[model samples]
Target: LREERIDTVVNFAAESHNSLAVVDPTRFFRTNVLGTQTLLEASRAAGVTRFHHVSTCEVYGDLALDTDEVFTEESPYRPRTPYNASKAGADHAVRAYFETFGLPITITNCSNNYGPYQFPEKVLPLFTTNALDDEPLPMYASTQNKREWLHVLDHCSAIDLVLRKGVEGETYNVGSGIEATIEEIADLVLELTEKPQSLKTIVPDRPGHDRRYLLDATKIRDELAWEPSHGWRDGLAETVAWYTANRGWWEPLKKRAPVSEETAWR
Candidate 1:
């Protein structure tokens, strides 16, 4: 980056697998926390003034299932899983660099992102690929776990906006404000693939699974004038079609981490 005279740095690299994190948390800390600090140090040494850190909404923990409360930029950090904890630590490191080193940095905590080129291990692509192959779609515990859905393109747009026009040392919560349960997602995937709902299999939930995740995207929406262009159903259907047409891309990934009945859904 110094050789190329890069002026902007966007850190999106992390060990983001929740299930894998539980199995091996050291890797998450190494990549998500230490790796972030290493990059921040390098960026400062390289004289890179602008740094954008992409984080996850999981760092806020879970909101009450019955409440309308959503996580905001000011929300207190209460991470539940190893993955979330590592990310929260990384977020702190980013802010520390900005405060102590005077590095111009902006952070974004985005909700669940689904779209093309997603690895099959994630929820949307996992269920989509399973439905395409007529395999059992694993559901963690019950379908009551609610998550705010955001198309990957919308997430990209929000990040771009923050990187270009956002204030330094600030954090933004980016989400679609659209929430859905795991059951609904499974049903939709089945309907789109013309598969039977019987393919949905309830698997043992992982330890410390958050019941609901909702983000208050008002800051990004009102301040940055950023909004999600793709709706839930349309984006999901388009994503299903993309995976069906581009089996070659996900097929190899599936083989690398073959989903089974015991596979934990993230």
Candidate 2:
């Protein structure tokens, strides 16, 4: 940063797969926790004017599926999985830098993102690619694990808002205020691809799986005037189409890092 004279830094790096974190947690901590500390130190040394850290809503842990309550900026950290715990540690470190060294920093906790070029290991890409190849779409047990779906473009916009207009030393929750079950999303993909629903196969759930996640994004919306322009179904349709047309982009990635049915729970 000193050599380049860059005034801003936005951290989007992380070992961000929940199931993979369970199998290999050491890497997650090293990358998400220690890596963040290193970046904070570098930023402080460089005297960057703005240091924005992108975080996941999983840092708040899971909400009860039966409740309408949503996670807010004030939500206490209750991370369950190794991935969530590592991210929580990073979030704390970011805030600590602001308080201790007076670094200009802001954070945004975003919901699940799906769109073009998503890694094939994630749920949407996994299912979409499997359907395209006439393979089975493995569904975790209960098939009801829920998440707030945010388009990647919208997530980018929210991060931009936080970097430009957000208050210093504050955390913002960025979401679409939309939630859906895994089963629902799978069905939608099947419909959009004109594939039979029988391709979905039920499998055992991962240990320490969070049941649901929804964010209260009122702070970003009301204060930063940020809102998601994409509807759930429309965004999903476009995402599926992108995957359908751009197999060359994702096919190579899927080949490089294949996610098997037994381990693609994230």
Q: Which TM-score value belongs to model 1?
A: 0.97
| Cα lDDT, model 2, residue 62 | 95
- Residue 111 of model 2, lDDT score: 95
lDDT of each: 0.92, 0.92
lDDT of residue 192 for candidate 2: 92
* Cα lDDT tens digits for candidate 1, 1-266: 79989899999999987888877899999999999999999999999989999999999999888998999889999999999999999999999999999999999999999999988888999999999999998998867889999999999999999988899999999999999999999999999999998999998888888999999989988998998999999999999999999988989888885434365443
lDDT of 2 by residue, 150-259 (tens): 99999999998888899999999999988999999899999999999999999878878899999999999999999899999999999999999999898888777554
TM-score of each predicted structure versus truth: 0.97, 0.97
Global Cα RMSD, each model: 1.6, 1.6
Model 2 TM-score, all chains together = 0.97
The 10-residue segment with the lowest total lDDT in model 1: 257-266
